[model samples]
Target: MNLLWLAVMILALSIGIFLFSLRWIRRWIREDIQRRQAASGKLNAIFEWAERGRQDSLRGLVLPGADLRGADLGPGQEGEPGADLSYSNLRGANLRSVNLRNTNLEGTNLEKANLRGANLKGANLRNANLKRADLTSANLRDADLRGADLKGADLWLTSYNSGTRWPDGFKPPMEAIRMEEE
Candidate 1:
């Protein structure tokens, strides 16, 4: 009878321990997920604030070398304001090696911006002013550049696939063509 009691106690203890451990693990995972979500929300808020400042004609809004992948920087739609960087002065900004895929840059002034090795795949740059911008070795695959001004811009070794659209009658440099071939 004593042995039987001891066995039953041991089994109950083991079950209690297992249940507690499982509950603790689940709590830890939930807390971790909440923490990550908070961080993401903070980052998005900062981006939105910066966009607002830029829209208010605040010059030199520096966001160079920022990881802005999948960020919506387009004009507002359906009463919701998106990030519109149009007419914003971004001269001499360091945007090197950043992912700007699918970003909107219509009519934005990017004069003398350092966009070396930046990935601009599928980005909309219609009517954007890129005068004297340093685009050395940048990836512009499938980027739309209709009506964009590229006067005095350096296109050295820039890569553009077949889907890339240039301004009307604009000719790509020899290096760009060679990069596409390779």
Candidate 2:
């Protein structure tokens, strides 16, 4: 009887240890997966927040080297304000062909960013730093660029309508194209 009881006790201890080890392994795997997904630049969480119109949640967001091509973070339905990404630092970000129409980018730092084919129509870019950024083929129609730093920025083939505002005494680059208001 004593031997049988000892065996039962050992078996229970083993089962408990096994269950604890399994739980720990599962938790570790789940956390590792989350870290890998985020590190891979899959900004699904950011996209979900943007889709939900969580502007406050996106404040001062940092997404350097992120692939945000054709993202529509623009104004919502009529009368709803657009996303406000003021003062965010997105240096070296890949914003190629993104739809940022009617968005607010005031005081944002976009140095060395690749903004080729981006649509900034009606976007407010006041006091933004865009040094050495590529704006090739970007739409600046009706966009407000007052006080923006466009030094070394590539404006080749960039189109701007009459409503687009530039810094005082600033002239558009020769490669900039003028477009008719829509």
Candidate 3:
């Protein structure tokens, strides 16, 4: 009789532990799935907003791969492209592989963002902040940079084709010549 009682208690304890562990695992999995879904939703929202120019009225949104070709993005505008964007905030955004030709970005905030392999030919960037950003393989030909801050920014393997423009009366560095070889 005592042996039977002991066996029942052991079995109950084991089942209880198993149930607890299962719940914990399930919770973790659910949280992970939720995180992924949120990230995907944010990415989708950014694209959708760029297409329609309105989504929850998010101001100064960072849009990657947006075609701002001749879009008027001046001050007090709805974050239009290729307009005077001095003092505009764009921290930690992905502008990778974008065509920002002739866009004025003077004194803009672009900290810790990914501008990798982007085209900025003839764009103005005087007094812009680009700290800790990935400008690797990006084209800044003929763009203005008289007082731009590029501390800790990556320029590795950046691109620069012909007909590229520079800042006001400024010339590209000798290292920039390597882009021509590619």
Candidate 4:
């Protein structure tokens, strides 16, 4: 009689553990599904906002490390090139320490932006409004700045190579500038 009772207790304990484990597994699955749903909703919103180029309203809405490469920001004119910005407004945006090699920035407004320590090698800045932009320690090697407004733009400690193209008859400011050997 005692042996039978012990066996029954053991079976009950095993069943209890199994039931608890199943509940835990279900909870984990439910949480995972919820997380995926939330992520999907956020992605949908990002796409909607990017498609419209809603710059002024994207201050806090743009996700971190957003991928906006090859996105067309707006209409381009003769001598101006268009490109994808990857959701960076860059209006007075601090691009210091950022590498933007070969990225298109045609007709983007970069007025008063801080581009210190930025690398714009082979990037297109055609017709970009860069008035009063701080480009200290920036690398503009091989970048196309045709028709870009550089009035009062700081080129302190900036690097320029022979491949870098400047606006018609314009040269990089001669203040603490470096020229790369061809």
Best by TM-score: 2
Runs of candidate 1 exceeding 4 Å displacement? 1-84, 177-182
Best by lDDT: 2
Residue range 1-182, candidate 2, lDDT tens digits: 99999999999999999999999999999998876677455467657767676454456766666777778777666545566777888789889998788878999899999999998888889999999999999999989999999999999999998899998888998899999955
> TM-scores across all candidates?
0.55, 0.73, 0.50, 0.53
State each model's CA lDDT, in order: 0.70, 0.85, 0.64, 0.67
Of 3 and 4, which scores higher on TM-score?
A: 4
lDDT of 3 by residue, 68-110 (tens): 3233232223244444445657777667776666667777788
Q: How would the candidate models be sorted by TM-score, starting from the highest? A: 2, 1, 4, 3
Give the C-alpha lDDT of model 4. 0.67
lDDT, candidate 3, equals 0.64
Ranking by lDDT: 2, 1, 4, 3
Runs of candidate 2 with Cα error greater than 4 angstroms are: 1-42, 53-57
Q: What is candidate 2's TM-score against the reference?
A: 0.73
Better of 1 and 4 by TM-score: 1
lDDT of 1 by residue, 1-182 (tens): 99999999999999999999999999999998886676567457646665664253222234432334334343333333334455655566667775556556677777788888877777777898899998998888888899999999999989898889999999998877433544
TM-score of 1: 0.55
